[model samples]
Every structure is written in C-alpha cells, then in structure tokens.
Target: MVSIKKGSLYIVATPIGHLQDLSPRAQSILREVDFIAAEDTRHSRHLLNHFGITTPLQSLHEHNERFKSPVLLQRLHDGESMALISDAGTPLISDPGGFLIQAAHAMQLNIIAIPGPSALISALSVAGFSADRFVFEGFLPAKSGARQQRLKKLLEESRTLVFYEAPHRIFDCLNDLVQIFGEKREAVLVKELTKVFETVYRDTLSGLFDWLNARAERQKGEFVIVVQGAQFDNKAIDPKTERIFWLLRQELSLKKAAKLASEITGVSKNTLYQFALDSKNV
Candidate 1:
C-alpha cells in the first residue's frame, strides 16, 4: 500500500542514535522499496528489523560501491524502487553511496532525498557555536603528523570548525589541537549524541585534554569537536590597513597574512595580529 514511486532511488537518512528519529516517510519508502542498498547489511538489518520492515538488503559500502552501482542501476531501469540507507545518519555524508548517486544521475533516473537525523547537524545544534558559516571536515588523519599538518591549515579559519574523531585517537587529536590551536582555544566536544550517555563538554583545548585524561570513561564514545573560530572585533581601524589585511588573509594563513599586511601598510605586526582575532576576522 506504500506510495513509493517506481524506479526512484531514495537517499534515506537513518537515525544516528535514537531509533524513533527515523521519519515516518522514510520508514514507508524503506518498507516498500524493491530492495535497500545499505552501507552494512548487518547493521542496517537491526534497524529494519526494529521497524518490522522486511525489505531485502544489498551491501553497498566504499569497497564495492563502484562494481555494485551498475547492478543497482539495472534494477532501477527495470522500474524497481530502491532505497539507500547508511548504518547511521544520512547516506553519503562522510559515508558511502555517493558513487551510486552520481551514477544514477548519469542514467537520467529519478533520485529522491529522504531527510532524517545527522550527527554533524545534531552536534552543531547543541554545540553553542556559530552555525551560520562553519566547516565540516569529517575526520582527521589517523597519524599524528598528518593530522597536525591538517589542523595547521585551519589555524586562521575565521568560521567555526567542526570535525569527527574516533575515540581511539581522540586524545592524540586533542593534544595536537592544543599544540597547534593553542591550549587556550575554545572548543566543544560532543559525545554519544542523542543516546543514553550523551554528553557535551566545552572547554579550552588544554582543559579538555586534562578532563579526558582524568577519566578513561570520558573518551569512550564517538565525538564531534567544534572549535570556536578566530575572534574578531568591530572597532574603527584604518580602512587601508583593513583592506590590505583582509586581502592578504584570503591567500595566506593568519600569521602570514597579518605579517605581510603589516609590512605593506606600515602598521605594527602586533596590531595587525590583534585585528586577526576580533569581530572582523570572526
């Protein structure tokens, strides 16, 4: 009795934690789809079973996405409705299924988006950071050096920064953040969002490190780290200096931008650096 359109591929968003977060529409489409393509058949099986959905499941993870797309597309061409679901959260946001979606477009097939829960958006909603303009740099590198190098690029980012970190490397990642972003940088760590042990811990980078180190239990869940962006002030300053500094910042890091702007404008380096941390830069 489900009204799912034949031959449409539904990019369904599953619940990140609480099972009830799944939309009624998502459940209906999933229940009636010809077959569901899932990131993990085993994990998606539990969710489907809970809702009493007996739809068949096919595995479509990062490893076999390329090879699997053609087969899935053929099913679509045969007028079969297909629903794609991840183990959790929306499919293709730091998860797989992007390739299949892309291939569907190339075939001129109807692709539907079924909105649902997302850990990234959920974390941002409660993190108390400015969400107007922020970046979602999914997960940092597992290795310390590569991760630190990656963090270095965002040192001057004026917009709020968000990242996902595994519990195993959370400590090392926080240590690198303290080392590069400075111990005093303001940040929030959200763990086990929307679940039983959901906790939101906001503190200076150094404080977070100590708190996590203090208790082994603190570092036991999935995490979303939201760091306050570079601060800026809305004070009157030389227009020429602002122009130069703003232009330089577009091409370089905060340190290099302030340094070069100071040189060009004959303004003190410290003064320009101060500009880098106010309402304007933020």
Candidate 2:
C-alpha cells in the first residue's frame, strides 16, 4: 500500500546495448519529468536526443553522487518529481544512487520504477547456460593473485556463474579462469551484446581463451562470462575422476596416481591418494 505522490521520483531503465530497446514509457517519463539525473550526461544526451526528449538533465555518477544526493533529495522533498537514469540500463545496479533512493524512501516520497533493459539479463538471455540458478559476479578483482583465488573458490559451485569484465582485462582474466577452473570446463562468452559486432561463443575454457588471444580485435568490447555448473555424483568419486584414477593406476604408483588425478581434476591430491590406497587394499 504505497501512496503515489503527484511529484514522485521515477527510476527508469534505458537500453544496455541497443538504443531501440528503450521503452516508450521510459521515453515518455524522460520527456515529462521536471528533471533527470543521469550517470553520464554525454551518454544520456545521445539517448535523450535520439528520442527528442528535452528534459533538463543533471549529473549523478560515482564522482559526484555523494554531494548530489542531498540536493536531489531536497528537490524531491519540494514536490519536484524527477527521473533517475544511468548511462545504460537501470540505476543503482553497478551504477550510482543507492543512497539517494534510501533517503527518498525514508521521507515517504513516492518512488516508481520504469523498467527496461539490463546488461546482466540481456547477456544471460543469450548465454545458453542453465538459468534455473545463477550468481551474478559484477566484476572480478583487478589483481592477478586475488582474481585466481576467487575463481578457485567457485570451482565446486553447482549453479551457473556469471561475470562482467572490461575489455582490457578480459584476456588475463580468462587465462586465470582456465588455470583455476580447468581447461575442460564449459563457458560461454558474450561480447557487445545487442550491439553491432555482438558475439556469443560457447566452448571449453581453454578454447575461448585461445580464440580471444589469436584475435586482437575480439578483446575490445565489454564481456560476459557464463560458466557451466559443476555436475554432482557420489559413488566414492565421479565417473570422470574414477576413470582418470584407474588409467593412472595402471602406470604409476598409488601416490603418483592420486597426484596425477588431482592435478587433472583440480581435486585434492591427498584425498585421491587415500582413495587409491583404499582401492589397492580392497
């Protein structure tokens, strides 16, 4: 039972990649609002201009969001309804303005959402991975060691894993993922989604890394990585691991077989070694 104020703050969504995806409701709201708070004035200018939306615009991004929150809150308090939009997609999602929204809520001011496109949702739509359960990891650590450690943490995750990466960091990031998650893990790489030169590639982790490395041009756009969920089984070990252990046992000692299996499967070598010893005892 939320009351609608005559001059409410409207949180609108713009297009993530395609300008045409901008909803008519979003366009109308942009045109009708007393003012609009945008993440990037220049980027939003192009969008507003394309639709002939001439509403007064104000900047509200990471650099100035803190100082501007109070001012925007004051405007809303004064019964001046405005619309908040990001350079692309919805606001407060890897964008700024979380504090301002909370402030508005506290004041009991009318708040509304004009939904449209989101990059995360857009990428997931074409990823072709299991969507029943997924985790949206906005961005990875910029450093090498930290990033690899994070990927290692998700090695056993049973749900699909999604991540956003900048163009400059894509190659190195993918390299680290292959090292941590194993070369055979399946992954889908979606780039510049919905925009020209958009590409969706589904392949093994090593293959995607090789493809990106071979083509310098392929590394220029924003990227989304969707990794297949881990398969779970219990019969002492997975079929894949059991087969590897069996093959290695034929040529190597029990300790060496476990080490080889652990390296190949990214499992614990000690655990595999104990299993191998138990099998020998049997």
Candidate 3:
C-alpha cells in the first residue's frame, strides 16, 4: 500500500489527454488522499470514474481559489491530506491552484509534487528545437493588440519560445507570429497532444499557417506552438556601427534610424532594427 502522510498537500499531475498517462503513484495518491481539490469537479469526476477511484473532489478554480485556500489549508491543519489537480496536466501550469500552493508554503505545511504529463514538456520534447533553453509563455493575451505587443517584446529572444493557444484563436496567433517572426522562421504546431487525433506539423511560420488552412479539422484541438528564436549574430555589429545606430535612433523612429544607419554603415536594416529592439534604445 502507498503511504500518504496526513497534513500534507500533494500536487498531482493528471493526464493532458490520454488517461493511461496518469502515473501509478499519482493514482495511488489520489485514491488515498483525504479528498482532491480540482479545477472542475465534473471534469475531474470523469477521470476518477474511469480509474474506479472513488475519492471525493472539491472545486478550486481561479474564481474561487482565493476564498477556498484558507478552507483547504485548515483541513490540512486538521490532519487531512489532500491532492490538488487541474482539469488537465499539471496543476498551476497555465492552470489554477497557485495561490493555494503558495499559502501552503507560507503556513509551513508539507507539500509534495507528483510529476506527470505536461503539455509544455510533451510539445518541447518532439519540437526538435533547442531544448537546452526555452521559454514557456503559457497562454498569450486573448486580444490581438495585446497579443501582438507581447510577441513584439519577445522579438529578439534567442532561445526557443513555447506557447499554448486555444482552437479558436490558433489562426490569429499563427498569423501574428508570421507577421512578427517573418514567414521563413521555423516553428512546430502540436495539436491534441497524446490523443487519438494528435497532429504535429513542423514547418516555417507561413507553411504551418497554410497547412492548418488546408485542413479544417486541423484547427480544432488544443495547440502548443513552438517557435525557433530569432537568428542574428549580435557580434556582427561593430562598435562604430552600433554607435551610429544609437545616435540615429535617438533622432528618428526605429524604422528611419535602422534605414539610415544601415545605409551609412553598410549593415542590414533588419539587424539594426533587431539590435534596437533588444537594447530598447529605439
């Protein structure tokens, strides 16, 4: 029998899609915990039913987590162990229950993490990009303007970029990526990961966009977009060129400054613009 200590909070990772992906330890913890706190009781019940695990569940989503954290913490203090789970994948990764975990730490309560399936890690493993270093942006802003601004901020990121997108906004997100990152930038779109209809499309930004449009069903699943970082030789800009570029940027807009600096120094305008963006000198 798996021994679950009392007065401890177990952070369990549920399967993102496939039910079998839930580890034996996670199942044991879930079955043995006093009760489970889930983002959605109904959704989690289904998973529990499949495994024949009859452990009771309580709701702890974004809207009510603030109010419920104390209540759950008190239960822990009363010697009741609990497991926290999101609707899918790991809890608190683009999901709720962060406040509860933080409170647990502050209260000096025991917290254990049972790691399992994560969409971010699953997508990155097969992305074939630089896995050594990467950034997980989670979900971007819903509105186009805010989303574009966020992408613009990461325009010069050299490490791989990972993001999650809903089915409805996948098209617009990919469009903005193409516009900001350029058509030829390499990217991978992993959809409905670990499920029967899983699809992994790898190509340039424009090519991925076209590939999605070519098949309507391709756009109808949870999406994980992995983008290759900007390829630029920062050392290519000599001190003389950088000095002139900074001086021009102060006097004119980024476009005009990059153009004038490029013409004067014989450096690429794109490189100058990227430099300005990275240094925030523009």
Candidate 4:
C-alpha cells in the first residue's frame, strides 16, 4: 500500500560507480520530480544527461545544506516534488542530506526512497564477512591519534565493522588497523567497486598492510574496509595475559612494544615490562 503524493521528497539512490545500476523506479522518480536536490549539481547533471532527464537541480551538500534545505523544504511546501540524490550511492549515507531529510520529516512531508546502489552494501556483499550484524562506521577520523582511539574501542567489537577511506589514506588506515586490531586480524579491502579495475583484496591486517605498502601508488579511489569480528579465544588467554604475551613475543629485546601494548590493553605496563625483562633473562 504505497501512497506517493505530489509535493513529496524522494530520497533516491544513484549508482555508486556504474550508471546502469540506477533502478528504473529511481529513474522514473528523478524524471517525474519537479526538481532534484543533489550533493553535487555538476555530477548529478552527468547522470541526468546520460538518462536524458532535464529536471532542475539544486545543490544541498555539506557546505550549504543547512541553509539550502530550508529553501528546498519550502519548495516542497509550495507543491513542488523534489528528489534528493548524492554524487553517488544513497543520500544521507556518509553524505550531506540528513538535515534536509530531518526537516522534511518534521514537516510531515511525503517522503519515499527510490533505492538503488550503495557502496557500503555492495562492498559488504562481496566482503565475505558477517553481514548479519555489522556497523557502518562511515569514514574514520583523519587524525591518527583520534583514529587510533576509535579503533582501540572498536577492537573489542563483536560485530563486523565497515569503514570508508580515501585513496591516499587507505594505506595509513590499513596500517592503523594492523596496530589496533593486531597483525593477524582478518579484513577485506574493496576498492573501485562496480567500476573498471574493481578489486577486492582480503588478508590479515599485517599482510594487507604489506601488500598495500608494496604497491603504494595503487592505493587510489574510494575504499571500503570490512574487518571481521573479534573472536573469543577460549584457550584462557585473558586480555591482560594476552597483551603480555604479544608484547613479549613481538618486542623480544625492545621494552617499548611491551610498554605500549600494556598501556593500550590496560594490563599494567610496569608489570608487563617486568615480565618482558624476566622473559629476556630466561
């Protein structure tokens, strides 16, 4: 029982990479709508030109969404049906459209979704990770310290974790993942999905880091990182003891690794540092 009305707000998902992925319903809605509020007018124009859709487009991106959304909402109030589209993929998904959608919802405007392609979903579909329960972390913080803090918290996450990273930062992001999730953590890096030269590389965090490092120039385009959930090691490797063991194993003679691991795992660096000393002596 779908009731689509005039003067509505249609949240349409555009193709993430390939234009053919745009659904027929999405195309119809975009063509039939009075105007389209797009994250990028120029990019939307390309899609519109491809489909021969000449609907008017207005910019409603991060730079001006708060100011522009009210105007779009007013147009909706004035009996103009508007469709919201991102540069690619779903709107309000790590994109600028949440505020506009919120205002529309608050005003009780008729809103409909013309679903199509989502980079996150597409990546997850091919990630070979648990899709049953996962969290879309959008994009990681650009700052290393903040990113590491967040990753530290997520290290204990029981559900699959998904994150988007840019080309230039993908390698650093993978390196940070190795540091926080440990070298042996399994992960999938999906790049250029649905486009020419699409790649899905899966391996341990350390191996992935090494692979990416070897091909530093190949780290380009949007990246989706799918990390497997934490597993319960029932072998009685308590968090504290595990931290000590990993530190002792990796550091060998260097006391810094043990001290850092203890600080990160909150297992008392002094104690672990002492253990490192004892193990070295043995």
| Candidate number achieving the greatest lDDT relative to the actual structure | 3
What value of lDDT does candidate 3 attain over all alpha carbons?
A: 0.93
Can you write out model 3's per-residue Cα lDDT over 112-223, one digit (the tens) per residue?
Answer: 9999999999999999998988999999999999999999988877779999999999999999998888899999999999999998889999999999989888889999
Reference-based TM-score of each model: 0.87, 0.80, 0.85, 0.82
User: Over the full model, what C-alpha lDDT does candidate 2 score relative to the true structure?
Assistant: 0.85
Give the candidates in order of lDDT, highest first: 3, 1, 2, 4
Over the stretch 196-230, how does candidate 4's per-residue lDDT look in tens digits?
97899999999888888887666878889999987
- Candidate 2 versus truth, CA RMSD in Å, comes to 9.2
What is every candidate's alpha-carbon RMSD to the true fold?
4.2, 9.2, 5.9, 9.7
Q: Model 2 off-target regions past 4 Å?
A: 1-5, 237-282
The most accurate candidate by TM-score is: 1
Error of 2 at 225 (Å): 1.0
Clashing pairs for predicted structure model 4, backbone only: none
What residue pairs are clashing in model 3? none
lDDT, residue 4, model 4 = 48
Checking candidate 2 for backbone clashes, the offending pairs are: none
Over 237-269, each residue of candidate 2 has an lDDT whose tens digit, in order, gives: 888998888888888888788778889997776
